[model samples]
Target: MPRYLDRDRLALLAALVAPLAVAVVLLTFRAGLPNTSIALILVVIVVAVAANGNRLAGGLAALSAAVWFDFFFTQPYQRFAVTKSVDIQTAVLLLVVGLAVSQLAARARRLQVVAITDADYLARIHDTAELAQSAKEPDTVVDHVTAQLTTLLHLRGCRFEYGSLIGHPPRLEPDGTVVWGRKRWDVDRLGLPNREIELRTFGNGRFYGRFMLDPTPGTIPPLQARLVAVTLADQTGAAFGTVGSG
Candidate 1:
């Protein structure tokens, strides 16, 4: 079960159990501590859970905290019923605040991931550009771009063809659109079509060659990554043009 359990499942389990454990520990001092204070403590727990997990995990933590608070700290102790209206308000706020905080935390996490990804994409482009500028042989640039595309697009393999192919395999356009058999394939929803996707390279308005990409099964690279791959191919094209002119 542990091997099968993913990160999300582990987070959800912690969300469901942490509040209950904390509530049980607080039960010892229930006679002295105010219910409001206990609710505050549970809110802290919910925030902690949300920070480490997703929105759903945060919400479950909040819900669990409220349930346990009602069961252990309310007027009718050891029961779910809450006799005081004040206790009811506290429970409701716990859920509401917990949910709101969870949403904010989730958004922050997403933004952080985007920032890291953007930085990495920039680095890949920068490195490839430098290599293209310094390398004398076009094969060097082609080989570098091929390796980069395989990793960037999560491809099984990538190879460079010296000239344009005769048949119309799916083409990855400059604008990062995938054209397959007279239709623009929805790479986002359907993943890359299970074929050798062609990413053509051009030098000074002339077609030099293409990079034939064999994507892994069910690999759906994001639009940003696809664009980076195109940019890398453009760098390769520029390198070919330089070598030809020289």
Candidate 2:
């Protein structure tokens, strides 16, 4: 969404404009324009739209291209009703090619976006680790980790609580679905606001300290976020290695 037009609106405009542009191109070579040429042109349009992550617009462009082919290029010129079997086949092929190309292009675009998103997560984790490494005190490390975790998980609040933490056995849900108490977070109550996820900083069965995150509603913390939290907690614990528990 930009200042001028949102993504959906831009897609809609592309859907309407792209097919018309292709039709104009077809009109220039109306005669002797092979059925293959029309199909190729329409496919190019569909792919262009779909590559922009606008599959709905690509589908609309595909349909329009099919209609334009029948109306302008077929024997029944200026009409959608195609009489010749060959023309009918060309029209059908044009539509199928557009749709197929659009599907493939859209899937590629989605995968590209996912790849970029994962890269961002990695970059954030790396930066946060570097920041934590430079921190001198346990509280400073905890504050930095809390800030990073809050932003990463879209949580409401997060902080470190120092105390003797009770160890719980690692277990799964009653339904045997998702892991619940990984460290000390309840997974059964997923999507519930104010849910706290506390990970212990201590390693080797020693009680050091704990960091807690209050997840915002509607956010089921991803696995990467959990891993990062656990790692941050460990780093914080190491910084407070010899300090007395709060």
Candidate 3:
């Protein structure tokens, strides 16, 4: 079995090297090929790299392609300086066009990933709603939501604390923000705290209980996942309200 480089590392390495390698091959025909055509070829390479990697890799590939194009194909062959005005324009345009296309490619990839993730989140919410509607007891709904949150948020454990707002643990708010004591916690950077974090559940504006989440150390769930967790809690709240009244 052969081990391959991870996507990020491979993409970054290609970004730094692919342009130079391609430019060297084009050097054989530099005398006959128009500089504009060479620049367009480099732009294509940038787009490919961007589609496969992150924004930083895409941007680096664009810069690398432009630099190599200037060095190899422009006037005063093998020099970085461009003696002709037209050659200079071509080089600049190559960089600009490459950067633009790379950005678009990266954004398209991101949108594709987000679209898939959103579909999964919607399915979870829909399933939870169905369970809440048909469940015989509110506790069943709470237990189900507990399991969902545990998996969704990558929590070490999750349990419901009924009544009384107990201690001032960190709270995951409806808007997906985390608050610890009086200040906002930076979940993206710091990850969730080691202690149990609370997500309160409400039924018809009445506080029912809280789900205390023990997060896996260094696990930082994305904002979308956090928002989905909040929605699931709300569904549990509705179930509680319905069962309590009945």
Candidates ranked, most accurate by lDDT first? 3, 1, 2
Tell me the spans in candidate 2 whose CA falls farther than 4 Å from its real position. Answer: 1-5, 113-246
Question: Per-residue lDDT of 1-246 in model 2, one digit per residue for the tens?
Answer: 574347656766887788878787778887777875676666677667766746787788778888877888887688769898877876776675566445545655654532112434434443444444445555776777778778876889877677745554232221222334544344436542355655567744566666666768877755444444554555466556634334
Best by lDDT: 3
Ranking by TM-score: 3, 1, 2
Question: Candidate 3, which segments miss by more than 4 Å at Cα?
Answer: 1-117
- Model 2: lDDT to the true structure: 0.61
Winner on lDDT between 2 and 3 is 3
TM for candidate 2 is 0.43
Candidate 1 residues lying further than 4 Å off, grouped into runs, are 1-117
State every prediction's TM-score relative to the real structure: 0.52, 0.43, 0.53
User: Model 1, poorest ten-residue lDDT window?
Assistant: 110-119
* CA displacement after TM-score superposition, residue 89 of candidate 2 (Å): 1.0
In candidate 3, the residue pairs with backbone N, CA or C atoms under 3 Å apart (3 or more residues apart, or in different chains) clash, namely none
Give the C-alpha miss distance for residue 31 in model 3, angstroms: 62
Instruction: List, residue by residue over 138-221, the lDDT tens digit for candidate 1.
Output: 899898899899999999999998876879999997656799989999988999989899999988887888999998998899
Model 3 poorest 10 in a row by lDDT: 111-120
Q: Estimate the TM-score for candidate 3.
A: 0.53
